[model samples]
Target: MDYFATVLISSLSSASILLIATLGLAVVFGLMGVINLAHGEFIMMGAYSALTATQLGIPFILAIPVAVLVTMVFGALVEIIIIRRLYGRLFDTMLATWGLSLALYQGAVLIFGSVSPGIGMPQINFNVGDYTLAAYPIFMILVAAVMLAGIYALLTRTVYGMKARAAIQVPDMARAIGIDSARTNTLTFAIGCGLAGFAGAILLPIVPATPSMGFAFVIKAFLTVVIAGPVTLAGSALAAIGVGTGASVVASFMTSVAGDLFFFILTVVLLRLYPLGVSAKWRIKL
Candidate 1:
């Protein structure tokens, strides 16, 4: 029973971390229909921003918003300059963003060097039936839950949410209704990048800030969003929980390689079963 409980809590913690990492991509690729290859770089940028702020004597907690703001502003500029022209051109957007990603990666390498220092993880731990567990991972579960709820509320209840949805779903109608679709789209994109920034900032203690760090996360993040299908947020949550928890559980009992194998195999089966995505047929707004 103790072993089982330990595995369960650890698995849930892994799932929560995955969920947090994937949320920004869900908003961007899922809602905006933009395949932002640079998404991972945005996350890297956030991590570096927070790290720099902390090094400059800013409290770690307060640095999170600073990272978000930096990324959001940069995202808006990218949308205005590059993404705006590439809308509806799938391959073009991918190529452009890919180039942007390379640029950002190289820039990071130049500025921060290949390897940079990592922030210390808060030393908080608890006993779980004789098995010690870090409190921060458990805290991630709550953070994931709150982030999910906050995003849902933001996109469903707010006027901005309604406008953003309208702009994405029916741009013609949205424009006809006197809504500035272009402006809404830019804001939506910025918000997505901001969310990515938030993820980097929050996960800094665990993941660290490195030039190549984005590569470690971007693929998995993209897969989670892709498997989420049409209902980006909810579907992503479900996918993260299913895949992340399953992998973590397997890793706890076996080798980490086995866990990765399970993750890939499960992803293949899911894609084969739901070609359009698990939430493709869901009759929901978000």
Candidate 2:
């Protein structure tokens, strides 16, 4: 029972982290239609940012916003400087973002040094009995919750979201009706990157920060989006939870990298069976 409880708690934490990180991918991919392979770089930036804040002697709570804000700005700037040009070329965006990821990762190594930088956890341990939970991570979970709620409200209740939905469903029609997809896409991408950054900062203690950490996260998040259909937020979240928990279980049974490969292959098989991105007959709004 103790071992079972440990697994359960660990799974929840892993799922929560992955869910927050991947949520942005669903939104960005849905609106932009560009995979933005460098999505992981945002995570890397967040981790490094948080690490830097600690190195500068900033309080952890204050450092959270610093990580989110810097990454959001970086996300938007990358959109304007690098991503904006890749519009309408899905394959090209993939290749371009791949190159961008490589460069950004190396840049991070240069700026922060090749050694993995560890962010110190705050003193409080957020725990429920024997499970050792950290307060900062709980803060991260709350952020994800708030973000999920805010996004749902925005997409379902607000005018900007309605316009975003419009641009998504019928870009030509939205444009024909005078909607500027370029503006909306930029906003969506920035938000997505900010969300990923939040996850990174929150995950600093759990996984620590390395130049290559983002790649592991991006692979998981993108796979979740692909399997769940980037267009459906609910589907994406569910897939993240499923993948996270499933990977934890597999890793407990075997090796960690093997667990990832196992989940990847499982997702591929499941996707082929469902096709249309795990949405069954539900189609993209566009």
Candidate 3:
């Protein structure tokens, strides 16, 4: 019973982490229909921004918003300059963002060197039956829950959310209704990047800031979003939990490589089964 409880909690924590990392990409790809290949670099930028803030004597908690603001502003600029021209052009957007990712990666390497220091994990622990567990990981479950709720509320209850959905779904109608689709899109993109920033800052203790750190997360994040389909937020939550927990459980009994293998195999099977994605036929508004 103790072992089972331990595995369950650990697996949930892993799922929460994956959800946190993938939320931004899901928003960008699912709603905007823009495949942001530079999504990972935005996350890396957030990590570095938070790291720099902490180094400059800002409290770690406060550094989170700082990172978010930095990334949002940068994201807005990118949307205006590059993304604006590439909307609805799938391959072009991908190629442009891919180039942007390379540039950001190289810039990070130049500025921070090949590697950077990692923030120490907060020393919080608790007893789970006979097994010891880190409270931080459990805290992530709460964070994921809160983040998910916040995003849902933001998208469902707010005027901005209405506009964003309108702009994405029917741009001509949105414009006819006196909505500034261009501005809304830029803000939406910025918000997505800000969410990515939040993930980096929040996960800093577990995953360090590095020039190459984005590469470690980007692929998995993309897969989670792709598997999510049209219902970006809720679908991503489901996919992340399912895949992340399953892989974590496998790793507990076997090896980390095996866990990755399970993740890929599961993804392939899920894709084959639901070519349009698991939630493609869902009747929800999100």
Candidate 4:
């Protein structure tokens, strides 16, 4: 029973983490149809932003807002300067974002040196039978729930959400109706990037921030988002649960590396079966 509890907790924690990481990417991809190769770099930027804010004497909790604000502004700039022109051009946008990813990685290495710093984990733990679980995972579960609720609320009950949906489904008609697709796209992208930044800040204590760290997160996040289907938070959450649980179970049976391999395999198989994603028919009217 204890072992089962441990596995369940581990799976839930992993799901929460993946959900946070993929939420922003899903939004951007679903709305803009732009595969942002630089999405992970925004996460890396968030970790660095936390570091800088803490150095400037900001509280750790407060640094999250600062990181999010900074990342959102940066995302807006990127949209205006680079992504704006490349809209609707998939290959071109991918190449451009790939270059931007490399540039951000190199810039981080140059500025922060090769290895970067990490925040200390919170000193809290709980005992479940003989197994002790870290408090961080519980906190993450809460954060994920709140974020999901927040996203749902934003989409279902806001003018921006309505405009964004309109821009996505029928940009020409929306534009004719006075909905500025450009502005909507920029805001949507910024929000997505901001979510990525928030995930990075949340992860800072768990993983060391490094230039190349984004690669791992980007792979996991992108796969999760893809499997979930674009633009659907419910789909993303369900996919995260499945992927995270499968990976955790594999890890328990073998090794972490094996778990990652299993995750990749599962992703490929699922994609082959459901090319449009598991949530293809259940798309929320955003």
Q: Candidate 3: RMSD over Cα atoms?
A: 0.8
- The sequence of per-residue lDDT tens digits that candidate 3 reaches over residues 1-286 is 9999999899999999999989988888877988898998999999999999999999999999999999999999999999999999999999999999999999999999988899898999999788999888789999999998998899899999999999989999999999999999999999999999999899998899998888888899988988888888989999999999999999999998999999999999999998888899999987
Candidate 4: list runs displaced more than 4 Å. none
How many times do residue backbones clash in model 4?
A: 0
Cα-based lDDT for every prediction: 0.92, 0.78, 0.92, 0.86
TM-score of every model? 0.98, 0.88, 0.98, 0.96
Alpha carbon lDDT at 88, candidate 1: 95
Please write out the lDDT profile of model 2 over residues 1-286, one tens digit for every residue.
6667666666666777888888878777754577889889888898888888878999766777899898899998888888888777899889988998999999998887778757656668745556665566556556666777877788778888888778767778888888897787677778788877877887787778889898778988888888777456777767777877788777876788877877888898878887867764665442
In model 1, residue pairs whose N, Cα or C atoms come closer than 3 Å (at least 3 residues apart or on different chains), thus clashing, are none
lDDT of 1 by residue, 247-281 (tens): 98999899889988898889999999999899999
Candidate order (TM-score): 3, 1, 4, 2
lDDT of 4 by residue, 1-286 (tens): 8877887887788778888888888788755677999999999998899878987999989999998999999999999999999988999999999999999999999999888667789989998889998999768888998998998789778998888888877889999999998999899899999998998888788866888878978888888878877546787788888887789778877899998998999999999998988888874663
lDDT of 4 at 52: 83
